[model samples]
Target: MTQNERIFLPWWKRVVIVIATVIVFALQIMLFVFAFQVNFDFPFNVWIYWIIEGGSFVLVYHIIHRPILTNYKLTWSILILIFPLPFSLLYYLNQRSLALPKYKQKKIDTILGNYYNPNQIDCTLELDRKDPKAAKLARILRSSTGYPLWKNTKYTFLFDGLLKHEDMLVELKKATRYIFIECFIISDGKLLSELLPILKEKGDAGVEIKIIYDDLGSKATLKKKTILEIAQIKNCTFTNYNPLGLNINPAFNYRDHRKMVIIDGKTAYCGGDNLADEYIHQKKRFGFWRDNCGKYEGEAVQSFIALFIEMWYISTKMVLKLENYLCDYVLERETSYILPFGDGPSNGAEPGYDIFRSLISSADQTLYISTPYLIIDEAMIESIVLAAKSGVDVRILMPGIPDKKVAWYLGRFHYKDILLAGGKIYEYTPGFNHAKNIIVDGRYAFIGTINMDYRSLFLHYECGALILLDNEIYKMKDDFLKACDDSKPITYEDWKKRPWWQKLISYLLYLFAPLF
Candidate 1:
């Protein structure tokens, strides 16, 4: 069956699309007639300009504005019709030429002013002296700008999605006050079904339950109405981030890719694993889908809760009670220091790329990295090369069988330079590996939605924790070693021996890497 047949569309959406198309067509016709009547000497070049300019405007308008339009439809429609063409043309050209103006930079700086903190270095040194593990973790966290520091926090790092799912279920069952879930892709599969009933029961018992899922991430997997219906039936609130529709903005590419769950403001989970059977290797199609996640308790959980609240408000227009959830719950038992960090497109000052770069720069012993995509920016590429050149052991594992062929090829484009610089590259031969993580110096580790790519760094919403404790770091290191065992190492000689056609394509993809 076709995708539309597989997932039903709302009747209202169909009516709105029809009306929008008519309006757009009418506006174009009116503009053409007015321009002709107003100026009898209108040149052929001017007419061609109108056709090209006006047509481009209509296409973008249809694609962006077609999605969710409730109270802001009229206002948004006016803005799209009046502004998008000229604005988009300018934006597209400037971005293409890498010539963004100073004002844009200032605007970005203003947005990200809160992302950086110079005091983190002192905190890292202090934590290291008091608890070596905390210090190491602090160093990693400090590497990334905008990552907040927490005084008292507990962290549990899971090796794979199996452990993550089991632990998440346990936490969900014990949730007493509230549960907030935000994920880029949430499939209605075994993992979700297991907790659905529990979430429903908790919601019925007066617990506040809220969820946000990205529309594009869940597209063709779950119907919007099905999600809304389930939310209503369970008395839980649900919102979709960046729903795709005609007349939608181009900024739809900036998606909420974070996968996090905060329970009662006491415990939280964040990592690369999504709420799907495939993530846990429960499905037969993808064999051994290895992934990782980190669980946080105490003060660190508060940061995650705050991140969830921010996203919830952005998606649902609901201001959550942050003060109530910010209570410090100190643990008597000794636990490693942890810091929860969040990143996104709006992260003007604390761009996730800078965080990843900082982590790469501070490597002492070894840096073991795992990610699905590797379309890295120039700075990240230089950092990895410099680290390897400086005698810091750097090993990276990418997918052998990628879900996106273009991304896989683009990932290989860096293999030659990485290997030449003394870095080791491995490709997991056993199906797709979707985990995004980095463990530095076998002391500091990070697991989150952010990939070592431009999309995750500057576009998508991402989150992860800077884990300092030795136990978690060791576990992540072991996981990386285990993954290496299942991977085939790509050497400099191997990359140099690539077929002529493959090399040509890889070179082309590399040129367009920034755009991707």
Candidate 2:
């Protein structure tokens, strides 16, 4: 079946499916309660009570001590306390890392060890001497992600999706050795139609092509024919990350949210645009789809190659030689320092969250952020509030036209706190602003696939590059300011005057923000 034809079900069928799912879920919950709470023979019942009481205590302790977000731990603790038996078992099951086996993890560590040992001590020391805040952020990112700070790197900010599409095609055609493309979503649309032919031609020409897309992310739009065509392409390997199944493991909650296009280990593209028609405006889902993408070369591209290698190993058990794909020559430009890094469930560290928090903490004059979702925890909110209260020009740009209403409402829930603390919030009046960007004092910038949501920060595999003291940061700042003019600002008065129904909806959704 064609992608457009098979992607959506009829209204009646969808309704039936929804009803069936709800019924089955309710029945399962009922059976679970009955199985757990029902009284048994005297001795057996006593033993069951002891096990439940003891296990609940231990699980609660472990949950509290887990190195996750404070809000996340609190929510899970409340759920466990309420449903001690089922939630305890569920927590244990969710903690298991079924997606990453021991060998694959060891392989990732082995691959990262090569790049981590040779930390750019000179670049770090120079940053420390010049700007201690930037130095501290760089040190934390390097230590957490094992991707060292790099100098002599070229960075280009692609503010428009169409520009990114054009630039990506040019880079793909120049690939003489290999191409690595990974995205959260890769649908069969105008974008993919234009892209697949080039990839197929390149693969036939002996340029190795590797592609990874999250199965759940693309399940609706990726056609069977598209998968087969990719499989049949010569010298091309397509692997889906974390296939959705009937398993009850927590891996199901995680996704490969990283997006990038790397060619010959010499050039790379990373940002928010996915391989979809809506992303580039061939077909618009929510008015004008405002997004940002970036193209870069030089030493930082090597780090992107390493991230691809690590994810490729996890998806396919075939290990790639780390040395085989690295760029041999450097561009030798002393413009700015860029550090490309990756984070996910493979390691317990929440580097994505840490990076965002650090950038927010280090903003001396101005902090500009653009994201599709603003679903963050209290700690991040505190950082934003602190920056605003300390007189930093903190501006956040969000989507006026939402693709997910619940998430949008949850985003609005935090507007009061920000506005009351002297921060400005703007919604892109033209359309859904899907770009994930952060510019600090026009001296530092972040451009990549990571969003300001819990999924992007805590649960998904994400990649991005931190640009420090670069001219590109000014471009990002300019773009952010121009976009802000196109957006509608939310003032304290406006927030207070919002509809009661909207406020209630946002309040209801706030409790589930972390999960979403």
Largest lDDT belongs to which candidate?
2
What digit string (tens of lDDT, one per residue) describes model 1 on residues 1-516? 122321233466457655765787588778777777776586785677586657666655653443321212332343445455664453343221132234543544443344433445665666767767446545444544345666556677787888898888888888778888899888877877787888888888888788899999999777666686567745588889867887535456678899998888888889898888888777845556878888887766767876777677556655666677655566543445567777764443344554577678778779888998898754467789999999999999988777888778778888877888999998888977788888888766678888877667656778887766546678778889988998999988888888887788887666446555
Which residue runs does candidate 1 get wrong by more than 4 Å? 1-42, 46-125, 128-147, 333-335
> Can you give the TM-score per candidate against the true fold?
0.76, 0.89
Per-residue lDDT for 113-222 in model 2, tens only? Answer: 77652548888998888888888888888878778898878999999999999999998998899999999999998888899899889998999989999999999989
Report the error of model 1 at residue 1, Å: 51
RMSD of 1: 12.4
Q: For candidate 2, what's the RMSD?
A: 9.3
Compared with the true structure, model 1 gives a TM-score of 0.76
Clash numbers, per candidate: 16, 0
